[model samples]
Target: MNAQAVRNYSNEFLNIGVDAAALGMSRSVVATTNDVNAVYWNPAGLVNIEDYQGSIMYASYFAGIANYNYAAFAMPIDKQSALGVSLIRFGVDDILNTTELIDSQGNIDFNRVSLFSAADYALTVSYAKNLIFKDLYFGVNAKVVRRTIGKFANSWGFGFDAGIQYERDDWKFGLMVRDITTTFNIWNIDEDAFATIQGAIPGQNQELPETTEITKPKVQFGMARKFDIGRTFHLLTEVDLNLRFARTNDIISTGLGSIDPAIGFQLDYENFVFLRAGVGNFQKTTEFDGSKSLSVQPNFGVGFTYKGIQVDYALTNIGSIGNALFSNIFSVKIDYSFFRR
Candidate 1:
């Protein structure tokens, strides 16, 4: 068995993020996340939850060719601790499988074609606790990942995440480390199914591919603050710096690592109606004349809360400026406590 460790694009689907509100802010909620969605953004913020909460989100990518969905639930264990669970799915369905299109007689038949789906799934369990020190919290996550490509290949992966958050006089800071112990995926290929396609292409599909994949650690640092405007309006702002160990095309890159900075702001009226905007994913690109230029993604969102139900919508991009189509994401959050009589 040939084993290989993939350093780039391993478990890339997980990076798509969850929650319309977070995506709207270009994923800059590390320091300010406090609801069920915190399970994905920064688990440490889960300790701030006061009651049972559940959230669901859905988004279509690449002009509806791919679908992404997320759900999460969280509850306080006690005055000092909380627990959460989250699930994510990203897939492309109805893909035509042409490997079996040609039969023993080498005759082409449209009926021989079949449809399949390529999908990725992740399940995460999280725990958070308030520290003995005032205004400090810590959290950890254990996650399992599964991926499938029709009946030809499948993989299973496991990983861990840790986070910490501190607050002082209306100011918050947070740090989240994803895949802290390095995630590993073991793949199993169906040789029988793959053999049917060996001759489909002259040189391709000649051999089974690598079976092992490794995902390295990533770190994010965030800071947030809130200000009161007049009597009924409030404004919140947050900034996050995401760091990857390898050098890349981020705005700030070096041999040691690369940094991607994101900034998000939210304005609300009486905590009922909300508006948000963010900018991030800065990268250097080459123009037609060979001149380098910087590109960024900007996102906008709106939210409304009535009783204990919150609905949020965001317009975001899956690719860099002018390169990909924009997606509309929607999410709903429910506070179970609201139903109590």
Candidate 2:
């Protein structure tokens, strides 16, 4: 089978929580993150955090049909080290299960029209410190993931991520490896609960879904440069290369394999306002005529900061895939420098 046919994976929620700024920049923050959100982007950037930092974010996705939320807190352990924790939740609520049941007389049963919820959540504990070498940093993230469907079925998984960063003058570089141990999801389905589903429809025969899925590791390398146009205005440009691997076969039929490149730009006015834009997720898709074409998505966002509080918003275009309006993302961050060095 081709890679596309066998591309079954689970726990995709791990990729849903993009901070507002990063989302605005089309997730081009791998080499530019410098706050609590670093825990989700490039943990190595955490070392740049001065004292204590916290972030909270929420987005109403898919026209409010679903939602995503994130929160993170980081504190310096010492002059050269820091610890952080992050949580993410993505789910849909009150979905009406329209599967109906009929009585002996073929009468409709209202009880069968129930509601259920499906949710995915993850918790990540991260640690970062400056490397022995100057201007270098390293970090790691330990994560636990859970997915549930109103209790009928649940899955649990664990994964870890590691990253390294180096900075020289106004240039920054980063390398991140996600799912370093090859994450796996073990699913447990309640047969008894599902038995009712089978009995509801006399001629229906349903089989249990797969119990496990393994997600391979992915690597991202990024570079960014900051231009101090003036003491009050600055520009940051970044590019990231993403690579996906497969177990035995080539990741994709394309000789280029699973490689995607993303680029972003951010403009800042002093420390008060920000503007960002980016394009990413480059890929080749077969057209109806059996011809392949290149495609990508464009995104943009804006932000404002005052005192120690910051707010950011982004609009991410899903292109023709979603057949809907752009996704709206937002986030807030606060830094407490009470113990600043």
Candidate 3:
């Protein structure tokens, strides 16, 4: 096959998001993220970490056929700067390899069958600093991505991201640019392993696949505000607009780009018990009658914190909106300072 650069759905695993809190909010926390998960959302929010923080999350997708995991750690460099590291992995394991199932004598050989996994991994290093301007913060991320498909092919990619956050009183705003300089992935295919499959099909799989992939830039703008309810309850609401430079099924689509809007709300009692809900992923779907209808995904979550240890749970795609299956996500966070006391 001719070598070509793929422009769509490259490195899509990164888009799955990290942390239960953020996913529960449909990733509307760009303006209010202030924990280890910020390493993936808006690194600029890492500056809000008071001390060393660590977080981990786990989720299963497609009815347990795939697994996703995330981990992150952040610490303050000083009073005005912070640094963080994060890793994400998404994979489907124990896939049966059938390429070698046929013996040279034209006999079926079940003994030769093997199992492998196809997985994608990403590592991000983030830095956030408080700017000279009051309530303004800046952050950047350096990312490395790796992908593997059993022993047949593998790829390596690199990218950069930049984000900024600004606050005025109870209102906050944020902007995040992913793949600011465009990300590129180069793949290497093993000819030996590929040869087995090349002959398995008459005309299909006769040539090598594309060797390059390009991920274009994407931007997200966010706004958030906090409201006080009496003296014991607080509500935080956020809205985010995700922009992609291609037409899609998003609610707002045009020739130049598409805009997908998301909104989230979080309520807390004395910052200890939390309840969250979000709506996002608006799309126009075609009905059986050739009519288009709007669909939205709704998510819900709950959390509890004690002694700086927080646990969160989220139910995503609650009603199976669109073609996505519902998933249950869980996450835990720990503050080192809590152990010091």
Best by lDDT: 1
Runs of candidate 3 exceeding 4 Å displacement? 317-323
Query: Per-residue CA lDDT of candidate 3, range 114-133, in tens?
Result: 99999999999999999999
- TM for candidate 2 is 0.90
Per-residue alpha-carbon lDDT of candidate 1 for residues 1-341, written as tens digits (9 for 90 to 100): 67797675689898888888888888999999998999999999999998999999999999999999999999999989999999999999999999878888989988989999999999999999999997999999999999999998999999999999999998999999999999999999998887877867668748688899999899999999999999999999999999999888899999998999999999999999999999999988888999999999999999999999999999997766656999999999999878874
Question: How many clashing residue pairs are found in candidate 3?
Answer: 0
Single out the weakest 10-residue window by summed lDDT for candidate 2.
1-10
TM-score of each: 0.97, 0.90, 0.96
User: Quick one: ranking by TM-score, best first?
Assistant: 1, 3, 2
Candidate 3 local distance difference test against the native: 0.91
Q: How would you encode candidate 2's per-residue C-alpha lDDT over 1-341 as one tens digit per residue?
A: 11111232456667654788887777777887878999999898899888889999888877888888899999889879999999999999998765455655779888867788899999999999999998999999999888888757888888899999999898999999989887877778888776666777658757766777677787889999999986899999999887776432221334434666789999999968999999886656667889867667788999999878889999884442425568778889988884342
**Residue pairs in steric clash, candidate 3?**
none
